[model samples]
Target: VLVGRDIGTVVIPEAPIKFYIDAAPEERARRRYHELKKQGKHVPYEQVLADILRRDRIDSERDLSPLRAAEDAVRIDNTGQSAAETLAQALAILRAKFG
Candidate 1:
């Protein structure tokens, strides 16, 4: 399953393949802000950004199962890439791997 940092490390270590999609904290926060706004939650952008940053720190420093990429997982950074580009890259990788 595509999931959080611990999925490959703890939950499904035996899966033959894995991928991890990443983005900058600011980008992540922006996405979250829009998501909540779409849901009609009237929250400020600054608050969402602060919470996103705080969660990043906590997840990074947690003792058990700290957030980290798997040793062999494909890492995809979507910082500046568009959604279409990201999907194409991901699909290309999968096709190459399984074809």
Candidate 2:
């Protein structure tokens, strides 16, 4: 149940089940925008998008423990999916792998 950019890749590479959940940068920015707005933050969507892209680049290119999925990790791209849909997808993976 660990969730982080490098958890599966660096922190615990030997974990039996690892998931690399991802979404389009625009979708990620949209989610962040709504989350910030709900928290009463007045950040613009474009700014959020730029920030996300910049952070992604920095994280992926950093020399120390750069972000990456484990070779055996399950990849999930929930670009246009709701939370429940994503959960269902993960659950299905778990079921398929463990049951």
Candidate 3:
């Protein structure tokens, strides 16, 4: 699982698998821009892109809890997939692994 700061330190029950999901900076920026616009918020694409880039840099370079996948974790790049497609893929993997 891809965990943010809050859940990273906790130990959960044993599971057979875990994965980290990520997308390219440009793709993430575009998605964020569209989501904000859909919510009737005014934000430019350039601003969203800049914010994503900045956050990406900070996440990668953070001294503690730097954003990275565990050695055994599968990494999924969801840049091109629609949300439903991504969820379907993830569910398929879970079923295959845990059934």
Candidate 4:
């Protein structure tokens, strides 16, 4: 299970199963804020949000290996879900695809 922004799109375009997991920007910012706090990093929530947006824009706009979902990738929107829930959804997709 390789995890990267461009794994499915660039590194391994022929992979059988690819999941593009996403969430709202605000939710992502909240999660990042908590993560940074857990690591003892002192950063404001608004600043974290701005950084996220800026990084997203840069990633998507970059000429090489831009961030994008592969054409055949399974898109998952886990805006308000826990990690376990997201895993369950991915597992469900695998089961349905292989069963």
Candidate 5:
């Protein structure tokens, strides 16, 4: 199974490969809002954005197992990329490395 965030640095540290995906705060919040809306979750955008920022800070600044991109991880910034586009990029990388 694919893990996220602190996967490489903490959980499954011995995994053969790892990736770090991130987006701008505003963009992430917007995406999250839309996703939740589609699910009928009526949470406010401001609240979601605030929570996202808060979680980011806490995860990044935590003393133990802080959320960090491992030195060997392939980083992907999906700020403007669609889900299909992002998946294609990842698949391309995987095929190039494994095939």
Candidate 6:
């Protein structure tokens, strides 16, 4: 289920799997910082961190579009995991469900 500020509350059939991908605020900040740097855009790490924190606060505290995971949604913490590891875990979940 794709729930966001742009998505309204509408019930839809055939909703089998729903996953909300998330990362730590600091980790996101760091990734954003590096991506910007790679593009030759100069931005301070502190600024990136602040921007990420601000986004988190707004997302969590929003009245109409607050960010939250569904009760039955599986939470995956990719904080310290590599991309390959995360992908493997997600694939494993799918295999278990379908196989």
1-99, model 6: which lDDT tens digit per residue? 365532322242234655555789788888889999999999999999999899888987988657666555556788767779877987888788888
For TM-score, candidate 4 versus 6, the one ahead is 4
Query: Compared with the true structure, what per-residue lDDT tens digits does model 3 show for residues 56-80?
Result: 7897788877766665665678998
Q: Write the per-residue lDDT of candidate 5 for residues 15-82, one digit (tens) a residue.
A: 77788888999999999999999999999999999999999999999998888998888899999999
User: How well does candidate 6 score on lDDT at residue 7?
Assistant: 34
Q: lDDT per residue, candidate 4, 1-99, as tens digits?
A: 999999999899999999999999999999999999999998999999999999999999999999999999999999999999999999999999998
TM-score of 5: 0.89
Model 6 TM-score relative to the real fold: 0.79
User: With candidate 1 superimposed using the best TM-score fit, by how many Å does residue 45's alpha carbon deviate from the native?
Assistant: 1.2
Whichever of 4 and 5 has more TM-score, that candidate is: 4
How far is each candidate from the true structure, as Cα RMSD in Å? 1.6, 0.6, 2.7, 0.6, 1.4, 3.1
Candidate 3: stretches off by over 4 Å: 1-15
Candidate 1: residue pairs that collide? none
The digit string of per-residue lDDT tens for model 2 on 4-84 reads 999988899999999999999999999999999999999999999999999999999999999888999999999999989
**Which 10 residues in a row give candidate 3 its minimum summed lDDT?**
5-14
Clashing pairs in 4: none
Candidate 4: segments with Cα more than 4 A from true spot:
none
Error of 2 at 14 (Å): 0.6
Most lDDT-accurate candidate? 4
Total clashing pairs for each candidate? 0, 0, 0, 0, 0, 0
lDDT (Cα) of model 5: 0.90
TM-score of each: 0.88, 0.97, 0.81, 0.97, 0.89, 0.79
